[model samples]
Target: MEHRVVLVTGGSSGIGKSIGIYLKSKGFKVYGTTRRLDSHPNFTDFELLELDVRNPESIGFAIARLMEREGRLDVLINNAGIGITGPIEETPHSEILKAFDTNFNGPIHMSKAVLPHMRRQEKGLIINITSIAGYMGLPYRGFYSASKGALELVTEALRMEVKGFGVNITNLAPGDFATNIASGRYHAPILSDSPYKEPYGNTLKMMNEHVDSGKDPMLVAQMVFKIINTKNPKVHYKVGEFMQKFSLFLKKILPDKVYEKLLMNHYKL
Candidate 1:
């Protein structure tokens, strides 16, 4: 029996890399994507391919190359995304657009590129790595949350659309993970004289500190493997510490204003 082929976007480092390696250990033939082949990190087990999710041509090319060789893409992990931090009012329009492009639109593009093949196979899984922020807005990270929320909605709609083809899809929302995402994160320029600078700086500081102390990326990888082993996956899976994952549950049950106050209070706003 042949091992199923898995493709993970943004696999050079962080969660993507962890998922790729973990899946490989489980006997899956995994291929991870980096924006540039030359920039791929020192990954030993799985193969690497060049893929820039923001570019449709690149997405198409990457999937095409994989299809040409594997003849089947059993699983696609849309794990590539970027983080931008700053006040919504102060963030550059271009920066916000870029966030949506890479986070939301990129997954859509990749999904579209791979769907036809998955449809042909009549069995496939697409796991999208979203964030807990998608459930509610976060200060200084509004656009990131917005982008993730948008993609979650897309996943919800797409799942209904693709069920007939035997394609399984789910949005995996991670609370926080100790990863290189902060180092590669895009920070908007905070002018010294800007009114929002003080709060923005404080919020950004808190956010990074939270992530620094967050759950291990391997935990998420393990969750991904579990999801794969299941015959029928859920529409959403939240992986992280109790509070982080439970907050979403709270939001669902609490009144809007109460939840808003709780969220604001937690962030020290």
Candidate 2:
């Protein structure tokens, strides 16, 4: 059998790197993309291609390069994302658009680029690394949630649209994981005298603590490998701590007010 070819965006570090390396260890030909190939972190086994998910031409170029080398791309992981931390009202409109462009539009662009190639092969998988926040809005991370939420809906629709073509798409909504996501987060300017300062400060601190204690990125990589090997994979998967994963179930079953209150309590809003 030919070695399966896989492409992972934002593979320079953290979850993307782990996924790329893990898949390679499983005997797949893995290619990871970073915006700057010269500065990419060390990953001895897999190939690293320069790609900027926010740029359509870059995405196509990287994919074409991989196809030239491998002939056929078996899987594409839309794992590149950015986070903005701030109250919705305080965040600049431009910042919100930037976040959405990277988190939501980036995946859409990559999927669009890969779909035709996958269709020609009549077999392929696109795994989107969304966030658990995609299922529910987060306090300081409103736009982040919104972006992932939008992508989540797209995944559902794409799965239905591509099922006939032997193309599988799914969203992996992960909880906080130990990664470099925090380093790239955009902090909304919060004035000391602002009304939301205290709560926002507390919430931001708590969010970081939760992230600091998050599960290893390799755990998520393991899950992705499982999904790849499964003949029939689900459309949505939650990869995180038990309670965090269970919260989505609660959100569906609990009354609106009840769920809202629980969320407020969780964030100390």
Candidate 3:
């Protein structure tokens, strides 16, 4: 009858927020982290921790505080991330670094911080929020896709590495969910006036439109809950509509050139 202790990063809004609330409703002792404390009002009935996933010190401090208070860490959802839209060539070095820091390195830092506690307990779950873009690359979202791809790889390696310790790892690769993740997309400074602007202009617009009309965020939260509770959890959970199915199909059935053509046509590239 013990309640599970769950920590969700970037839980102030979007999929993370929904997931946090859903977990809370399931009787979990949920702790949500956000970089902006002002936005904490959106998340009620859950402990709020101020954390910037990009900062190792912030991650370490938050984990330490949680461990000190609760004495055990049952689940860690690395959900903090940022998206960048536009051509890869037009993305500034600094912006790319920022994307990687948040999307890729952040989870790595959090996982490292939580490992000791989970290792000690010999039982825990780590759910990493990846994207469908991780499986199938999208136009004007190269950097974002790359970051998620890195996360997918990390999730795989960690899954195997932690199995010996009885710690489970799951990568939640949700397709276009109705999250504000699209609105949260950052444009690189170089992309604003770069030569590649004209070429990728329409593609960017289409990308935004697709994201703006994405699936419900709650679907992702439900899937996450399922993954956590399942006896034999999948390493990767793909959700959403055409994107999820298409991504998996391309990986398994389509020829490289055929998939490339379809992707180009789909994105108007």
Candidate 4:
């Protein structure tokens, strides 16, 4: 893994930044992308490139610059994403679209953009940073779940499609982490007169609290390093507390209504 060039989208902060720093410390050439390069004047852990996953031009330019600089892109970590929470009915359609564009389409486009280069070299790995919530439909976070879940499934199919080309793609679904995701999350306002006010409001409060008390982002970085060093990586990887990861196991075994009831009870709905 030494001197291998890695690109992490949304690397200016949080999990992406942590991964970049950790990899750089291990002697890998790492580059991170933020939509705005000037916003983070102090982010010197690794080179940060300007890119907005939702824009095709920005994606191409960033990928081109990295390819030119390093002459190769060894790994692509699709870690850039946004968090959205609100009653699906109450959340603006625009917000839903934005969430999907960033969380789902952006990664697909990124994978597509990098495939040619990877195929040409016949060696590359793409790690999609998804969410545990993506495994199930969570209350007030349906769209967010859908977007990540979409990426998860896409990774499954893409891995097969590109396996012969010597390219590997995988999903790393993390549980809540103490990142700035809360501040950037688009929260549907709690309308006082709305029918779902109390539940949505309570859920929103719980969501933010979970993030505030979540584990460090460095754990994810460690996993990223491990996956890179492995000769054969899996299609999906989860990093989080036991219960958070266990919940996915439960979802697989629990009946439909039982799981729904459990979620409702957990959120106190």
Candidate 5:
């Protein structure tokens, strides 16, 4: 088989970095994008591209550069996103916009930019990195969940829309992965004083604790490779241990009230 050319956004660190490295190890020509190009840790074989997914021009420029050099893009991974922790009411509008721009719109723009090329070739794969929160709502993570949930829907729609063109779209919903995702390094809006301050505060604390104990990002990267290599991959792939099972089961058998109660108890709400 011919080696595939893969592009991963937010590849400077965490799951994106792991995927880029893993794909390179498997002999794929991998190009990784990062907002902070200078800060990206040096990876021997992968190409690093500076891309701000929120900017349409940036995404276009990056894709143009890649296509100019590589001639074709076989796989595009939309993994650049930010995590915000706050109650829906307390979260500022600007923060919500930022989340949507990065999480949802970014992927949409990237997909659009690459589609012409993919369609012309009549073969390609698009992998979207969403979250378990996309499948199950979490306390104090409403904004984040909403953003990811939107991406989930987009992925599903795109999958069917591109089927005739031989393009596959897969959504990867990972539970908690060990990464700097909760470190507030990406971007966030200022918190405001509100009536539900205590619950919001407590929720943020709980989120930090849970994220600190999350699974290795390498596991997620491995799953990405598996999905891409498969001749016919599933529309959705869930990673992680407990969260994965819980999300799947809750969506299938649990009642809304029961699921809500379990979530509240888990988060000490």
Candidate 6:
């Protein structure tokens, strides 16, 4: 059997890197993309391509390179994303747009680039790495949530549109797996004299703690492997601590205000 080729965006480190390495271990040909190849001097887990998801030309060139080498691409993990947190009042519009570009728009463009290739092959899988937070609006991370939430909806639409071509699309919403996402996220500096300073500060600290104590990214990678092998996979999947996954269930059943209050209590706002 020929090795199934995989392309993972943002594969330089953390979750993307884990997915790439694990898939390679399973005998798949893995190509991971990083904006700068020189950034990680010791990264030799798999082939790293230079591509920024925000730039269409970059995305195209990288895929072209992969196609030239591998001849066929079988899986695309839209795992490249950035985290952003700030009070909506203080977060710069430019920064908000940047988050959308990488987190939301990046996946859409990557999928568009791959769909043509997949359609020709008549078999492919696209798993989007969304966040559980995308299911609800978190206080300081509203923009981040919105961007990811948008991806979830788009995945639903894109899945139906491409199923006839033997292409599968799904969203995997991970609650919080220990990774470097916190470091790369855009955090609005808490203003000392601002009205939201106190609450925002506390929430920010709590958010970091959650990431620090979060589960391993390998778990996410394992789930990715499972999704790849499953035939007729579902449209939405969640992987995380039980309570985090349960929170979504609660939101569906609880009254709107009740859920909102629960969130406020969770964040200690």
Q: Output the lDDT of residue 143, model 1.
A: 93
Better of 4 and 5 by TM-score: 4
Candidate 5 residue spans exceeding 4 A from truth? 41-45, 185-193
Q: What C-alpha lDDT values do all the predictions have?
A: 0.92, 0.91, 0.86, 0.94, 0.85, 0.94
lDDT of 1: 0.92
Model 1: per-residue lDDT, tens digit, 169-265? 9999998999988988889987899998788888888989988998889999999999999899999999998998889889889999999998778
lDDT of 6 at 206: 95
Q: Which stretches of candidate 3 lie over 4 Å from their true place?
A: 189-195
- In candidate 2 the C-alpha lDDT for residue 165 amounts to 98
Better of 2 and 4 by TM-score: 4
Native-to-model Cα distance after best TM-score fit, residue 63 in candidate 1, in Å:
1.4
Clashing pairs in 4: none
Clashes of 5: 0
Please provide, for model 4 over 1-269, each residue's C-alpha lDDT reduced to its tens digit, 9 standing for 90 to 100. Answer: 44899999999999999999999999999999999988998877999999999998889998998888788899999999999999988999999999999999999889989999999999999999999999999999999999999999989999999999999999999999999999999999999989989999999999999999999999999999999998899989999989999988888899989989999999999
TM-score of each: 0.97, 0.97, 0.94, 0.98, 0.93, 0.99
Candidate 2 residue-wise lDDT, 1-269, digit = tens = 88999999988888999999899999999998889987856656578999999999998898888888889999999999998988877889999999999999999999999999999999999999999999988888889999999999989999999999999999998999999888888889776888889999999998878888999999999999999998978999989999999999999899989999999998888
> Could you tell me how far off, in angstroms, the CA of residue 107 lies in candidate 4 after the best superposition?
0.6
Between prediction 1 and prediction 5, which has the larger lDDT? Answer: 1
Q: Which pairs of residues collide in candidate 1?
A: none
Q: After superposition, how far is residue 94 of candidate 1 from its true place, in Å?
A: 0.2
TM-score of 5: 0.93
Each model's total of backbone clashes = 0, 0, 1, 0, 0, 0
